[model samples]
Target: MKRLTITTLLAVALLSGCSSKEEVIPDVPPSNLYATAQTALQSGNWTSAIEQLEALDSRYPFGAYSDQVQLDLIYAYYKSDDLALGEATIERFLRLNPDHPQADWVVYMRGLTHMAQDRSFMHDMFNINRFDRDPTPSRQAFTDFKYLLERYPESEYGADAKARMIFLKNRLANYDLATADFYVRREAWIAAINRCQQVQRLYPDTEAARESLKLEKTAYEKLNLQKEVERTEKMMKLNPAK
Candidate 1:
């Protein structure tokens, strides 16, 4: 009984010591914690910055630095390529601070984050076509930027969002044209024409829209639709591809 009691006490003491060491957060002032986070951010130590900022946020959520903490954390998540956490942080911020003066800026950051996720590293390194991949990120980014424009027309990010929207529009339309090209190569003229018409209907002013016209002409010719071919030829003349 004596030996068993001693062993139990030793095990309890070892467990206590391990638990004490796991309390890694410093017992310091919130100001000091925030300063440490700032230093980490300035030095591009994203993981360290996240730890310090999260500590400050948890300890003093209603303190003077609460809002800024959330913003900084979101930026840190983006820089570290922790996209899921960044998106969640942005959503929480907007949900709680819907009328914040910096709401537009937050919205802009969300759009930027989505666009960042849309880029494919393999495509960039291998010179492969990124448009062939799933475009859900691009679609989400386009929607986000569109919302930014509609909600805050005078926002500083308005012009940039508009430009990105245009690029996204072309990207989406080009994807459709690429699929249409595949159908044409397979001799599926109707499928090819359907894809071309989709591009023309939705992104009529895009460069992809002009390219779609050429595909439409080819698909019509293959289908033996002479009059439709003539119509597509006239539309191609009106909006020639550059």
Candidate 2:
């Protein structure tokens, strides 16, 4: 009787372990997982799409849809407003598949992610100046877009990237102008002059160029650099709208 009880207990333990193991692991096929993720993406359910894609990636890292899954994951993360994750995923994709046919799309999406993050609630809703806040993200976006234009000028997205680059350049110039204005207000003549000079040299055709020239003139006058003041005044006259 004792031997029979011990045997029954061992059988029960083995059955319990097997049941727990099966319950813990899902038996999803790779194709089904990819299809489910695609469906979620098509339905605009970005969060669900991410979850499914992530599952597929973990289970079948080298599956037929692995590359496509990574690409879709980037879009899903971006759509879900997970900007940091989206950016990281794109960088990974670029690093791994630099010559991928869709490289231009990846680069463009990365630039868009930065641009989207640069816009804040205050800037969008209250019409607050973006230059009043941090400009790092905007600068980064501008760099990304410029790189895309330089590397893939004939890309399908080249025109849009170029347009965004122009907008970002203007914004960056305005940011420098704002800094110059602040320095002028604080009577930091040299710093003000430097900021204005950056705007004039780097963003000559931008609207900020006019304000930059005006600021530079004021700074030069404050520093008693009469020659510089005259030169700036002459330049400003030559380009009245500058």
Candidate 3:
């Protein structure tokens, strides 16, 4: 019985010593954290993955794995609903690793962020949607999508981006006309004319411009503006097909 008791006490002492050592040691290695983070990502545990990957910030500063970890960290921030951080990280990554094979993916992801946040003009006036006043996001989305279309037309997402570009073009043209119509209704003839002219300059091919021209002619006629109306009519005659 005494021998058994000694054995038990020794086993307990050894376990206690090992636990103390583990408590004092930083148990996670950079590689292990990265691997675990990847596994968590694959399982769709984005929050957990971000937590693990972010812990490797100051450690493992010079390895190939470190570069990959940073890339994955950007994705984790995006997937975990931390878009601001994700965008900043992506920009930094692009600047640091412009030649990286996956750089295109980062650009595309940024474009997607812009597209997803885009809003129409009536969003606030009609309580339609969020981000109504900012055409900046939509414009950036269009620019990026156009870049992909012109340069990487055969990319997997290129076709979809092109379709989105078409939709955005029409939507933006409509927005211009809507602004002109608003000014017209408010009897702001100069603003209305300027906006109509802007639509023609920016989106001459759209139906919105066609509609805007007709409305502009009416606005000029209402103000008894003979010269401007005559000029507009002469232009329409020159381009009869439009």
Who is ahead in lDDT, 1 or 2?
1
TM-score of 3: 0.71
TM values, all candidates: 0.87, 0.85, 0.71
lDDT of each: 0.91, 0.89, 0.76
**Residue-wise lDDT of candidate 2 within 147-206, one digit each (tens)?**
898988889999999899899898888899999999999999999998888988999888
lDDT score at residue 53, model 2, on the 0-100 scale: 90
Q: What value does the lDDT take at residue 108 in candidate 3?
A: 76
After superposing candidate 3, which stretches have Cα over 4 Å from the reference?
1-27, 119-132, 151-154, 226-242
Q: Using TM-score as the measure, which candidate wins?
A: 1
Better of 1 and 3 by lDDT: 1
Candidate numbers sorted by TM-score from highest down: 1, 2, 3
Order of the predicted models by lDDT, top scorer first: 1, 2, 3
What lDDT would candidate 2 get against the real structure? 0.89
The C-alpha stretches of model 2 lying farther than 4 A from their native spots are 1-26
